[model samples]
Target chain A: MTKTELFNQIKTKKSYLCVGLDTDIKKIPKHLLSSEDPVFEFNKAIIDATSDLCVSYKPNIAFYEAMGPKGWQSLAKTLEYIPKDCFSIADAKRGDIGNTSSLYARAFFDKSASGMSFDSITVAPYMGKDSVSPFLEFENKWVILLALTSNEGGKDFQNLELAEGTEVYKKVLEVSKNWGDSERLMYVVGATRAEKLREIRAIVPDSFLLVPGVGAQGGSLFEVSKYGMNATCGLLVNSSRGIIYASSGEDFAEKAREEAQKIQTEMAEYLDQFLK
Target chain B: MTKTELFNQIKTKKSYLCVGLDTDIKKIPKHLLSSEDPVFEFNKAIIDATSDLCVSYKPNIAFYEAMGPKGWQSLAKTLEYIPKDCFSIADAKRGDIGNTSSLYARAFFDKSASGMSFDSITVAPYMGKDSVSPFLEFENKWVILLALTSNEGGKDFQNLELAEGTEVYKKVLEVSKNWGDSERLMYVVGATRAEKLREIRAIVPDSFLLVPGVGAQGGSLFEVSKYGMNATCGLLVNSSRGIIYASSGEDFAEKAREEAQKIQTEMAEYLDQFLK
Candidate 1:
């Protein structure tokens, strides 16, 4: 999906929410185990329940991969199930050398090759330009490069100052911005570092930011929207555990909708407060 | 495989060569298309032909993933077929948050969870300690961190100097060395940057270095061995296309063996010249 299309979806929904599908087999309701593909069944329910409450769905690829071939099958099915109106993110965190990365781009963007194609795939920037440029070659497909991540270890290297007097993550932002425009490229900035959003927005004011670390990770949606929102409302604040696993009972899907509704309502208020 | 066992294999074979199975379906010989699983059939023949000539097999995960679930099945069979004496590497280059990284660890390290177990897996260090530490928790499994990559884009951010006066990749080596001992940790210092090996050696002198970019990528065996080799012959120089795609016809396996033999012969000389 194009950046304008993504923003239109946000405006229509009155939410910049990107629900994360970090589904764990061990954590899901035991009753779903009777099904042939429990992971897919669970995701189907979650997507059905909350599709209208969010503008995008980010499936953490590791969760499906941990289950082996069957996991991949479930992942393929889930990708197919996500509504075309809602943007899809593979969240695969894949990047390699020029040739190898082209194959990765094919895997995620060319559904004919990999049985699944996402609107965007998260990529690591450690390998730099060539590793990331391959994904950008597929017109309209997005590359969400990792910036300031939410995890505790995120500070280990990302926060270190470069000799030119900028942090590593800042340098990553400055250098990588030229690789693709706001139309084709986005950044992953953790919501836990909400204060940094103001500084980050200054660097790439128009580019979208995929913000994880809300709710369960203790990032306030209000603060994130205040500092991160752009004229086009270029912010995709993601919530996984806080919404999907809200209830483990048979009403799991229903309860998930409730949690998503709570976030969407708040997001609507923020859209009015910030964008109006 | 343990570090001592890996070194012993190098001593026994007199070769630190790592044969990379970057098997692309389009690149393999047409005759293999008749098989139920052409990718697996190709890998099986290559493993049988070159297992003796190399001490390790690093399967580039992107190629397998491009084919989807079937590709993963081929990968599982290929991993199981590799000889017991040879070390195995899943060149997946995967790393995520703490919990997500644990799932990635299970995907590569636990046979029961992911249907394929590798002795080591390549990891990207951009996310820092937590993203990498989960993989280290697995006993006897290895984490070969991407230090100085062989690609042209490796210089993009890795060569950036920190405010503290050290390069980013050098700081990665210094800080991450404490994450795991040499027994369970390794670094990927590309043969393309053979000169940097000497400086990298000063930081983590005893840890094994998985060096790619030999042959097809224009890296020299003699140069890498001279600067990178240690008391244990601590280097696994990888050659993917140079050996595996040496011949694209019926004699492909035999030609692969011949190419691997050529590298093995040179590695033997390096072992003698450097270690003796």
Candidate 2:
């Protein structure tokens, strides 16, 4: 998916929230345990409940992967359940050698190969050109490279200043831009790093950003939107536990919708402000 | 598995080859499509043929995730078929917020929760402490962090010289050591960067190194072994396509075994030298 298409969705839906499907089987309602694939059942419910409120749905690969085969089934099913207009992301932070990355691109973007095609996939930029170029090779598909993350250790390296007077994360954003244009490339700048969003925006003003660490992680939507947003409202603020596992009881899906609604409501206001 | 356990297995098998099960459905033998799960069937045959010759199996999650739910099942089954003595890695490069990462840890390390318990997972270290800590919470499990990768773009930011008199990747290795002991953590130093491996060893001498790019990516196992090996033979050199997709025909599995044997024979020599 291109940044322009993502922007159009943001404007049309009036929401920037990317509901994170970090589904955990243990955290799902007890009733789902008996289903053939409880994780998928939970994901389907969450998608059905919150689809209208969010512009995108990001199913983190780790949550699905933990379940072994069942988790993968859940992820595929979850993608199928997600509204096609709502951007889908395989939150699989994959980056490797060029040839290997090409296969990974085929796996995620080529429906014939993997049967699960996501709009985008989270990629780690540490591997450089050969690792990232393969993901960008797919036409119109997006590559969300890791920038300044929301975690505490993000300070360990990302925030470190180089002799060139730029931070490591900033350099990652700058150099990775050469691989693909803003249309096919996005960045994962953690929502918790809201303060850095301003600096990040200056680096890649036209690119869309898959921002995690909102909601349950204490990253403020208002702060991120105000500082990071571009003319097109280029952000997909993700909320995983806050939306998917909002309630562990039978009303979990309802609770998830309610949580997602609250975020979307706020996102609508952000879009309105940006449009103005 | 602990570093000692991994080291002992490498010594006993006389191989440092960590055959990467980056199994793609498109790349698997056509005959396997007749099976209930082609990816799993291929992985089973590959493991059956190569188990004695190699000491580790690393399954890149993207190949399994691409197939959706069915692919994951194949991965779980593949993990099950791999010999218990051989270390199994999820190769799921996952890192997120603390609570979310906790769930990820539960998903990968807690077999009761996911059915596929991998000994280690590759992690993108950009998120900082909270993102990485949750993975470390699981006892005896490991977090193989992206340090200096083998890809061409690795020099983009990882090799950038910081004001602190160290390169960005060198600093990542230095700071992340405090997060966990060598037993619980390893660094991914690409085999293509063999010359720099000596410098990396100086900083992280005891930590296990998950070295990719050794086979088809043109990284020499001989060069990597010379500079990257430690007292415990701390190297899990990976070769993905070169071994796993050695042939795309009926003899695919047999071909995989032959290709793996070639690397294993070379690795056996490396191990012999380590013992000397």
Candidate 3:
């Protein structure tokens, strides 16, 4: 989806929430275990309950991959079930050398080839430009590059100061901007580091930022919108475990809807306060 | 497999050549397309031909992922088909946060959970210690972290000088050492940058290095061994297209064996000259 269309969806819904489908087989309600595809069934319920309250759905690929080939089948089914108006992200942290990365692009962006096509795929930047540029070859498909991750390991290398006085994450932002414009690119700036979002904005002012760590990771929604929001409300604040596993009983979907609604309500107020 | 076991295999085979199974559906011999599982059929032939010459096999995961679920099934079959003596490397450069990385560890290392258990899997160090540590949790499995890649873009961030005058890749080698010892850890020091191997060897003298960018990518095996070799002849130099696609006709398997034997012949000499 185009940035404008994504912005329009946020405007229409008065929110910029991207509910993460980090569904685990063992974590789903026990009652759903009888279903042929429990992961898909649980995701179907979550999507049905909370689709209107969110602008996108980011499925954590590792969860599905843990189930093996059968998990991939469930992931494909989940992708097909998502509403077309809502953006889909295959949160698969994939990257490699040039030719191999092209196949990865085909894997996530070419539905006919891999039986699933996402609007975007999360890419690791350790391999640099060629590793990330292949994903940009598909028109309108987004490449969300890892910038300052929310994890504790985020501090290990990303925070290291260069001889020129720039941190590695800053260097990633400065160099990668030349590879793709704001329309085709987005940076994943962790919500855990809301202060860094301001620094990130100075580098890529117009580009959207996918912010994880808002809920379960102890990142504040208000702080993220305060530092990260731009003219188009350019922030996809993701909440995975916070919303998906709100309950484990048969009313899990209803409980999930309530959690999403609460976040969306807070996001609407932030949009009014922060939107340029 | 353990480090001693791997070293023993190299000594017994008189080579450390790793034949990369980067099998693409479109790139494989078209005659095999009539089979029940063409990719598996092609990999089976390649494994049968080159198993004796090479001490290791590294399958580039992107090739299989592009074909989707069926491709994964073929990968499972290929993993099972590889002889126990040969070390298997899942060249899937995957890493995420701690919890997510654990799932990835299971996806490749826990065969019962994901139907594939490789001896080693390549991991990207962009997210730092936590992203890499989970893979080390698996017993006897390995994490080959990307240090200096062979691609043109490898110069992007890896070569940047740190504030303390150390290069980024060197810092990765230094800091990540604490996460896993030599027996469980390996570094991907690309063969194309053979000159840099001398410098890398300084930081990681004891760890085995998985060197790619040989053959098709124009890396010199002689230079790699001269600069990168350690006690136990610590190297698994990979050659993908040069061996596997030596012939596209019905004689593909026989031709592949010839290419592998030529590399093994050179590797044997390197072992005799460089083994400490």
Candidate 4:
């Protein structure tokens, strides 16, 4: 999905919230467990409840993967359930050698292989060009390169000033941006790093940012939206547990919708400020 | 598996090679296509032929993920097929928020979930302490953090010198190391950076290094072993395409065995030197 399309969705839905589908079997409502694929059932209900309110749905790969083959089936099925207009992300932080990475690109982007193609994917830039370039090979698909993350350890390296007097993550964003245009390359800047977001925005103002750590991670939505947003509403604030696992009982999906609505309502207001 | 067990396997097999299962459906032997799960069949054949020559197996998760539901089935089945003594790795480079990361840990390490558990997993430390800590929560399951990668873009940030007069990757190694002991943590130092291995080793002298880029990416085994080897033979040098796709014909398994054998011979020599 192109940045323009993502922006359009944000404008149309009046929301920039990306509801994370980090669904775990243990966390889902017990009543759904009896179903053939409880994970997918939970996902379908969550998507049905929250799709209209959110601009995107981000599914972390590990949750589905833990269930083994069944988890993958649920993921593919969940991908199908997601509204086409709503951006879908396979939050599988993949990075490897170039040849291997190219194949990974095919697995996620090419429907011929998995019949489940994500609009974007979270990529680890640690392996450098070969690891990241493979994901960028697909047209219209995005490579969300890891820059300044929301984790506390993010300060361990990303914040470190380099010999060139720039931070390591800054260089990552600078060099990685050259591999693909703003249309294809998005970055993952943790929502908690709101102040740092301004500095990051200074470097790649035009690019979209996949901002996680927003809701449950304690990153304020207003803080991130105020500092990081661009003209195109260039921010996807992801809330996984804060939304999906809001309730573990029969009303889980309903609770998820309510939580998502709360965030989306807040997002709509912020988006309006930019629209104005 | 502990480092001692892995080291003993290398000593017994006379090889330090970890054959990577970066299996691509398009690249597998044609004969295996007739099977219910071609990827699993291909992996099984390769493991069977080369099991005696190699000490561990690293399955790149993207290969299986690309195949979707069936791919995951193949991955789980393949994990089951690997010899019990051989160290297994789910090369699913996952890192996210603490809560989400905990689920990922459950997926890869919790045998109760999939009946398949890996000895280690590659993780992106960009997310910091919370992201990496979840993986460390599983006892005896090593977290292989990306350090100096072998890819072309690796120079973009990994090599940049940080504020503390340390390279970005060096800081990652230093700070991330604090989250876990050497026994629970390892760093990925690409074979292409053989010359710099000494410097990396200086910072992480006790931790095991998961070295890639050896065969196809032009990293020299001799140089990497010379400079990177530690008291525990702290290395798990991987060769994916070089071994798995050694031949795409019917004799693919035989050819894979030959390819792995060659690397094993060289690794045996390195082990001899290091053990001495």
Candidate 5:
């Protein structure tokens, strides 16, 4: 989807929420296990319940992949099930050399090739331009490059200070600015480091930030909003465990919607205060 | 395979050569297109011809994945076809958060999970220790972290100067040292930076190094062998296009063997000088 279309969705939904589908088959309701495709069934319920409450759905591909070919089948089915109006992200942190990356682009963007085309796929920038540019070839699809990640190990290299006083990920954004525009490129800035959003926003003010590490990771949605929101409300604050795994009972999907609605309500207030 | 088993394979074959299965459908022989699975057929032929000449087979996962589900099937078949003694490296540069990384580890290291089990996987360290440690959970499986890549874009972050006068990749090696030892871990130091191998070897002396960009990318085997060799002949120099795509006609696999044989012959001499 285009930037303008995404902005319109954010406004219409009154939220910049991107519900994470980190669905673990083992963690889902045991009753669902009797079904042929439990992961897909679970995701269908979650999407059905919370589609109106969020602007996007980010499926962490690893969860599906851990289950094998059947998992891939579920992932493809889930990708097909997502509403076209709601942006879909295959949070597959994939990147490699120029040729290999082009194939990865095909695997994610060319549905005809991989049987799944996401609106965007998260990428790692360690390999530089060749690793990232291939995903940009699919017009309108996005490449969400890993910048400042949420995990503890993110400090290992991402936070390295340079002689010029720039952290590694900031320099990553700076160097990568030459690769693609805000229209086709987004950045993954962890919500746990909400304070860094202000600095990250200064570098790429218009680009959307897929902020993971919210609720369960102890990041406040309000802090993520205050520092990260742009004129277009370009902050996709994600909540996976806090929402999807809220209740593993038969009402799991309903409980997920409740948590999503709670987040959406707060997001609406921030959208009004920040965008008004 | 363990380090001793890998070293034995090197001595048994008299080569640390890693044949890259970068099988491009368009580049394969036209007759193979008639087969049920062209990429797998091609890989089967390549493996049948050169299994003894090389110590390892590094299938660039993107090449297979670009073809979709059938691609994965071909990969599984090819993995099953490789001789039991030969090491298999999934050249899938995958890394994510701790939980996600474990799933990825299962996807590659556990055959029952992903229908393919590789001895090692090349990982990019941009996300840091958590993204890598999970992959090390699989006993005897390896995590070959990307340190200094050979692509022009490799200079972007891997070569960045830190406040402590250490290059980014060196810091990656330093910080990652605490995560896993030389036994379960290795580093990918591109063949183009032959001189840098000495410095890298100093940091992780006992660790293996997967070196790509040997022939097609203009990296010399002699220089790579000179600076990179350890007491265990610690190098798996990879040559993809130069080997697999050696010919496009019916004689493709035969020519692949010939090219591999030539490299193996040279590698034998290097082994004699370095290991003797």
Candidate 6:
């Protein structure tokens, strides 16, 4: 999906929400375990319930990978089930050398080759530009580079003090601008550091930012919009556990929609206040 | 596999060679493509041939993942076929948040869960301590963190001036020491920067380093040993194309063995000089 198309989806939906499909087997309703593929069934319900409430769906790849080949089949099905108008993200934090990285690009972006093609894939920038440049080759496929992650580990290496008071992730943001433009590039700015969005916006104002760690991770949606919102509402605030795991009963999907609706309603108000 | 077990294998085989199973569909011989599971067939042949000379097999995950579910099945079978004594390295280079990282750990380390129990898996250290520490939870499993990569883009953020003389990778080597010890932790030092091995050794003297980019990527095996070797012969120098794709014709396995033997012979000589 093009940046303009994604922004248009947000404008029409009045929500910049990205529902994260961080599904786990043990945590899901026990009744579904008898099914051939529990992960896909769970995801299908979630997508069906909240497709209109959110602009994108981000499936954390680790959950499906844990289930092995059957899990991959489920992920492919889940990808196909998502409404085409709604952007899909393979939250597979994959990056490698030039050639190997290109293969990874094919794994996620070339649906014919890998059985799944996501609009974007979250990439860790430890290996630098070439590791990321491969994913950009596929038209309309975005590379969401990991910048200030939400996890406690994000403090370890990402926040390292470089010369001239620059942090490692900011340096990542600064130097990576040469590799690709805002049209094809995005940054994973954890919602925990909502304040830092101001600094991030100053560096790459137009590029989209995939903000994980809202709700269950204790990040406020309002603060994210207040500090991170750009002209195009350049923030994809992701909520994974809080939304998907909202209920353990048979009405799990219904409850999930309720949670997504609540967040979407709040987000629409943010769009109105920030944009208007 | 434990560090002591790995060191013993190096002593027993007198070779620290790691065969990289970067099996690509387009690159493998046409004869194998006709097989029901060509990827597995190709990996089985390579493993059967070089199982004696190489101490470990590092299957670059991209090659298998690009083929989807069947590819993962091939990887599982290949993992089962590897000799019990020989170490297995899933060159997946995967790392995420704590919960997600544990899932990745289970995907590789917990055979009961994912049907593949690699001895160690390569992890990108971008997310920091918590992201890496989860993999260390599994007994005897290892996390080989990428420090200085071989690709030209390694110069981008890895060589950044973090301080007066400290570069990003060195800082990764320094800070990561706090997360896990040499017993459970190693680093990926690309062979292109063989000179940097000496400096890397100063920071991480005892921890084993998985050095890739040998013949195909223009990294000399001798330089890697001279600077990177320690008391335990602490380096698993990998050669993917030079050995696996040595002969694309009918005698592919034989040619692969011949190429592996050539490297093994050189490695044995290094072991004698370094250990004796």
| TM-score against truth, every candidate | 0.99, 0.89, 0.99, 0.94, 0.98, 0.98
For candidate 4, give the DockQ.
Answer: 0.67
lDDT of model 3, residue A35: 87
Please, what are the lDDT tens digits per residue for candidate 3 over residues A1-276?
Answer: 999999999999998999999999889999999989999999999999999999999999999888889989999999999999898998998999999999999999998899999999999998999999999999899999999999999999999999999899999999999999999899888844556777889999999999999899988888889888899998999999989999999999999999999999999999999998
TM-score of chain B of 2: 0.96
Best model per DockQ: 1
Output the lDDT of residue A227, model 2.
82
Worst 10 residues of 3 chain A by lDDT: A190-199
Clash pairs of candidate 3?
A: none
Query: Candidate 5, B263: how far from true, in Å?
Result: 0.2
Residue A147 error, candidate 4, Å: 2.0
lDDT of each residue in A1-276, candidate 4, tens digit only: 677888888888899889988887877889998998888888999999999999889999878877877777888889988999999998888777687788678778889888788998888877788788878878889888888787776776667777777777888888888888889888998845566877898899988899888877788888888888888888888999999888888999899999998988888888877542
DockQ, every prediction:
0.90, 0.58, 0.89, 0.67, 0.79, 0.80
TM-score of 3: 0.99
Worst 10 residues of 5 chain A by lDDT: A190-199
Estimate, for each residue in B1-276, the C-alpha lDDT of model 2 and write its tens digit. Answer: 778888889888888788898887767788888988778888888889899988889998767766655666777788888888998887877776676677778777888877768888888776777788999988889998888887777777778899878888888899889999899999888844556877888899898889888878788888888787778888888988898888888888799899988988888888777643
Deviation in Å, model 1, residue A192 alpha carbon: 4.4
State in Å the error of residue A177, model 1.
0.9
Cα lDDT tens digits for candidate 1, B64-113: 99989888999999999999899999999999999999999989988888
Candidate 4 per-residue C-alpha lDDT over B1-276 given as tens digits, one digit per residue, 9 for 90 to 100: 987888788778877788899888887877888988888889999999999998889999878877777777788899989998898888877787677788788878888886678898888777778888988878889999888777776776677766667677787888888889888998888744555887888788988888888898788898888888887888888998898888889999999999998998888888888653
Clashing pairs in 4: A128-B153, A128-B154, A129-B153, A153-B128, A153-B129, A161-B163, A162-B161
Which 10-residue window of candidate 2 chain A scores lowest in summed lDDT? A65-74
Error of 1 at A48 (Å): 1.0
